[model samples]
Target: MERVRITDDGFTTLFSTEFNQYYHSVRGALDETQRVYIELGLLAKMQETNEINILEIGFGTGLNALVTALEAQKNNLTVQYTTLEPFPISEEDVSSLNYQTGAETDLLQKLHHVKWHENIEISPNFSLQKVNCTLQEFKTSQLFDVVYYDAFAPSSQPELWTVETFTHVASFLKKGGFLTTYCSKTVVRRAMEQAGFKVEKHIGIWGKREVVRAIKL
Candidate 1:
């Protein structure tokens, strides 16, 4: 896939035609991640728990992972984060996506050099493991506390949005655990319901009308 830079909401955003839309926007993309997904959903759940184990479906641009790590650092929350990326981007490509001005270069380096295939502690409370494999092939013996289902739009990769794959993911989520997605399609909502999740429509960000947040019941 080819990456192109575009200006969206005052931020220089990067996107691949393979995945629709911009990577992020200055005005609202980061806000969407921080407010809707992280704050209202993920962090809210973590507040009631002593520790959290997060599984991210698509580690695109490493934005969600970074935010999670930063939150763990700030809140002294213990986190075990596992991220999956089938078509992982190169280090240079990730570096180019750091459009946020004044961001520490060390975070970028840490992001690029993080060990893959094994759990590595980046801090006392934050540990990360990257699996360089597609979702269909990965195997896990543990259930997660939360899941960030940030795959490409359903139209771009329908297979990942199917009930079958979601069922597979459900096997790895503890009872009462939550999964958040930026998609609100009928098929996707139905798939989550079929996978035994209690699905609900959530407030969307960045000019979006709706999103989906589900809890495994």
Candidate 2:
């Protein structure tokens, strides 16, 4: 059975039964996401253009998408976010995730309830399309300004950490687009580099020491 696991940062994340791991860092779910995907990936792209198109590999708990939507509304930026998830969390579990209260909680509800494969505008600045498929099965001619490579760890899903998978995902990026992930393992970094990215290591807090933001030049 699945359950909610509270991280060290007071926020809660779910333990994936299929993957047998926590969705986000055990130290802090919200903190880790804000640091990695938002800071290293989305915000960097936003500095260049107010309009952004984001491609996320996993829609696990919708935290990444929720945070992105909040940022877009706050900055008055336009965002088109697409996420891929093969096995979505059930509604009961989604409601149980204690991220925040009031409007933030409501926003999270909107994110989970939005119909899949159809673009829905959550706010004036943010639009989302959730695809219920794994990255290997995802197909689209569209390219994105940035990618949030928030998949399970290499230990949980080794197949996804290979050069071939990185190369396949790279095709989803537009020219100059970069992919940011919470993993900076030597083997993973090498795979990303071999897949044609200029990988850079960023200092990370919590359990992991470093994260990576790889650019496709």
Model 2 misplacement above 4 A = 206-208
Worst 10 residues of 2 by lDDT: 96-105
Candidate number achieving the greatest TM-score relative to the actual structure: 2
Q: lDDT per residue, candidate 2, 1-217, as tens digits?
A: 4478888888888988888888988888999989899999888998899999999999989899988988888888999999998889999888878865565668888899999999999888999999999888989999999999999999999999999999998888987898999999999999998999999999886545899899997
Clashes of each: 0, 0
Candidate 1 local Cα displacement, residue 145, angstroms: 0.5
Local accuracy of candidate 1 as per-residue lDDT tens digits, 1-217: 3364534444334676656655554355566577556875568777789599999887777777777777887788999989998877776677676534354446645765787788988878788899989899989998898988887777778889988999999999999888888788898899999989999887777546687789999
Candidate 2 overall lDDT versus native: 0.89
Q: What's the true lDDT of residue 108 in model 2?
A: 86
